[model samples]
Target: MLTDPTMWRPAGEMHRCLTDGGSAFTEIFGTPFFDHFARDAETAAVFHDGMAAMSEPENEPIAEAYDFPPTGTVVDVGGGHGGLLVEVLRRRPGLHGSSATRRTS
Candidate 1:
């Protein structure tokens, strides 16, 4: 869905997320974008996967270069699907982690 131009072209036309009623996502979806993404199982999966895929590459350099402390818990704030956390944990076996992201029921 994200790959489709039809889905997002309207945002440019609509001036999204810039003015008071400016959220094109909210306007189009009739809900907060994240909430709308989470409303369906398949869509939520695609959303998280896309987010993880987009973010994972950016996280690799940080994970590789960072010199973690010998012991303690690492928190991956907004760590969608734990990809970055997994990489960090794989690199530092002694470290533990917590991932925080949206909760869906």
Candidate 2:
């Protein structure tokens, strides 16, 4: 649903004219993405879990592609499960920092 073009479809008087962002989706769904997500707990959990799962496959190549400072601090903002952070720090060594978005129950 995220790249749904119809969500941003233009309407009358909006023929290539810009308007407030809400005007885009409001005409169709009456609510925006964030609002919808917040209102639905199951959907929110799915989105969060999906995002966390996506990080694992990218960790190896990402670590291989970049050469982090041999010794310093590194932080992944939403470093889900610490997969990428662990790979990077393992490769670089001696780096220290904290992930602000650590998951906790």
TM-score top scorer: 1
Clashing pairs in 2: none
Model 1 C-alpha lDDT per residue in residues 53-73, reported as the tens digit of each score: 788787778888898886789
TM-score of 1: 0.76
* lDDT (CA) per prediction: 0.74, 0.64
The positional error of residue 28 in candidate 1, measured at the CA in angstroms, is 1.0
Estimate the overall C-alpha local distance difference test score of candidate 1. Answer: 0.74
After superposing candidate 1, which stretches have Cα over 4 Å from the reference? 4-10, 13-16, 19-21
* TM-score attained by model 2: 0.55
